[model samples]
Target: MFKHAIAAVLLASANVAAPAVAQPAPAPSTAQAPLQLWRLDCGEFVIKQYGAFFSDTFQYPRGPKNIVGSCYLIRHGDRYMLWDTGLTDALVGNTFDNAAQTLRLRQSLVDQLRQIGVRPEQIELIGISHWHFDHTGQAGRFPQARLLMGRDDVELLRGTPSPDQDSTDALAHWLNGPGQIQQVSGDHDVFGDGRVVMLTTPGHTPAHYALLVRLASGPVLLTGDLYHFTEQVANRGVPPFNHNRADTLASMDRFDRIARNLGARVIIQHEPADIAKLPAFPQAAQ
Candidate 1:
């Protein structure tokens, strides 16, 4: 009986898995290339009367504020996306000025892209934060790229003429070919990997959105007119032309919460001061 028991114990010990040697995580699958972001000099427009045009309650100081028409180029692996086309290239030589502001473009977006060996055709997607003229000015340049915009804004573009409608010429390509438009209703993850996302924060327009780019350096939040200037972040100032004041306030609160949670670098696209958060043009944030 003792000998039979000893044999059973030996067999059980041999059958037991040999301590299940742990292999070193299979080398992590050659981690995907880091994402890259480029700040493009789309154009600039000086708000002649900041208080009159920007703040509905005249919260900001009274002075001419040089609001930048900033654009961004994001590269994830091989795919590329352009955010906010900025003021029209035509504004380069002839600075268009009205009672509210003066729009000017020092360099064309195409030329800027050319400097970094990126062509208009190379862009896979064009992200419009809003349908304003300044943001969609150069959108026509990339007709082949998919248009990702707010659903409400898209409806406005397709509906009858309204004050919110700009020339509509820049978006004529997408307008004519509705197939190319992606009418985003809520937060959108551009790459599915969660590297690039568009957060819907409407107020400035019916469907305005802010972009969140996850970079190796850190996350970045591109305020798509959510807060034109940094001051709006603190004061929760809503522009006089905003569609809904309550929605704007809520969006501001949400934006602040997100930035705080992610420890993100917030870049007010129109604010000249925010430009320094990223590297100068030609160079990229990776």
Candidate 2:
């Protein structure tokens, strides 16, 4: 159901006696250039219960229940970063059935990324919105990239038996890879220009996060499960199963304050309506 042989990194034992070769070194990622943002459809889930997404705060609001899994790509000069990889590419043909949600893929994430001329290896860094399986689906595809995740999430993944069955067992390989994991203390600036910043928006998990990419057109805030529904943005619906209810509400408050202050378009990653915030695939926002 998918083409994964070329996922990235095929290592082999070295031939120390092999002849010396000359090759051109890849250019550094510091070259200044305008940023380009591309949105990709990773997968979608069928939500049967409105109560499933929120706790006591939710009142069975009327709206569509289906939610999308959004994966984002950011190109800064020669540097590339992937934010919140959707459901695993291996799950392309299969269905994810569990207590939290049931996800089915429209297309593999790598295939969508390839449509825009980005190979897995081209991604210099992978920013995990949090350690949830839905967001870290293809993390194993880019083991070469430095994985920037919240310290609390790192701890979450380290414990036995993942919180959600939606995760890929192979993702553990990527997380445990040598020198690939970079546990962030809090917010991290991907570039020195402060254009791409990772905000620590915990509560959804112990230390969930949101990505803020400042493009020439405008600032875009990719809310990572801070609010699954657009109505949550207004009603402040806190998921019942979230790690900490107080923390979830606090995180929502901070998220709203930042969105209002930046005058940025807040994209509820699951809500399909927010897809219009960026140009369709093959065309970038900036």
Candidate 3:
């Protein structure tokens, strides 16, 4: 019953494709040659609650905060890793709208992957940013791949979610299934070369984490929920619904420190402006 209400608020809360970044045509791709990163358009959403309600977590919540749901696909050598699964394709029928803004599904993630010649079986790993419903919508689709998640969040899957269409319920099968799961505690180097690493950034959830993808172009950081919008970066605002306020604040400081040290370009998962920094789908960021 505790998480059931969260499901309701989430469903109630929450489009636009950021314009593509200008860049030269991508280099030719090979299975073992180039590292490829593709950003998929999972879905889009806008907050509908009044200003006072949103102000609890946001600094300037004057209007409906429109944001996009993003997922990523990375190809390293012959191995493939999926960042976040995005919203469930099955639920694409329901359109969300408010007087201020509206969000509709432009495409499905499975379809997006298919466009890039990636089959579900070709996915070697599925790394979830957190345990949110939107992020885990398509996780169960890849049964052959291993699931990587925070140890703290992995432990949360032991119980049942309120029948209110919770994400915990959507991801429960994979969480409890026969597939292998890597429960990470702190920082993790995915390829052990520092090219691809998982940075531990909490606050949105107990075990929420982020990803760092290095390419020939530069290093890119996928901020899970550390800062949903670019404004949150400067404001350093904590949502009212976060798991731990102090944990969130600490993670923010660390998140910025590492990026500054490496000069990484931070990409907020929900911010459309940040999405514009990446090459559009079908164009790998390598």
Candidate 4:
């Protein structure tokens, strides 16, 4: 039915005749620039009892769950923007091991970027999902880039004795001086053309954000710890450590509506399954 309807529209358009009057030459086109997106592996962690970490109400079945960490590289025209920094480079060789969790990075983010011919210096903007260690770990490596993060999350980092010492230390350059930083209060159109946007969700953290990348293939939504796993989306599971329960629920509602309205391909950042939505590393989604 859909194909036939499209065919009918094409047939009707083909039947139209050109105007008899001569028209002036058209000016140079000013269409929106094209975009490209690439997903890179930052790290992975395994929780002994994933249910306890991702839910406040025992929503998920008790068992080990390996959560993957990811970082994204976006190219808008000639400029490049990086989303999230993932785990620290220090984790490349050593692993953070404990009874509750084990975290490690298989490769440094810079190394992965190099594999795809992107250098840390080439990235002009770094948009962070939130002020979490796992996400801000390697931000310092890109000191030349302007950092974009939630306003509240920036304030948290500015405060004395930050809650997450690792993140605070990693982002010290942005907090103190030298490095540029932009504290985002609401949804931010990164490139000003609306092709890329940072959706302010703010439940997992005070200023958490989900990224929306408009690719030629489709609109892709990157969930920033909004739903750790697919099951969380079904049960509306809120992590016990989330900043606000009510805010989380509201953000989830907004996220869902945006995804449905845009018919976006939603990729839960930490979910291994969602990570496979895009082409493998080194290949971009254009």
- Candidate 1 lDDT, 122-157, residue by residue in tens: 999999998888898888888789999998988887
RMSD of 4: 9.0
Model 2 clashing residue pairs (backbone): 55-240
lDDT of each: 0.83, 0.77, 0.76, 0.86
Candidate 2 vs candidate 4: the TM-score winner is 4
User: How does candidate 2 score on lDDT?
Assistant: 0.77
Candidate 4 lDDT over 1-286, as tens digits, reads: 0000112122224556743444554422225676889998989999988888778998777889998999999988889998999999999989999988899999987898899888889999999998889999999999999999999999988888788889998998998878999988888878776678899898889999999888878899999888888988879999888898999999999999999999999999999999999999889998
TM-score of each: 0.87, 0.83, 0.82, 0.88
Ranking by lDDT: 4, 1, 2, 3
Model 3 misses residue 45 by how many Å? 0.3
Q: Worst lDDT window (10 residues) for model 4?
A: 1-10
**After superposing candidate 3, which stretches have Cα over 4 Å from the reference?**
1-33, 50-58, 96-103, 160-165
> Against the true structure, whose TM-score is highest?
4
How accurate locally is residue 84 in candidate 3, as Cα lDDT from 0 to 100?
Answer: 88
- Per-residue lDDT value at 225 in model 1: 88
**How large is the C-alpha RMSD of every model relative to the true structure?**
11.6, 12.0, 15.0, 9.0
Q: Which stretches of candidate 1 lie over 4 Å from their true place?
A: 1-30, 164-167
> Worst lDDT window (10 residues) for model 1?
1-10
Q: How accurate is candidate 4 locally (lDDT)?
A: 0.86
TM-score, cand. 4 vs. native: 0.88
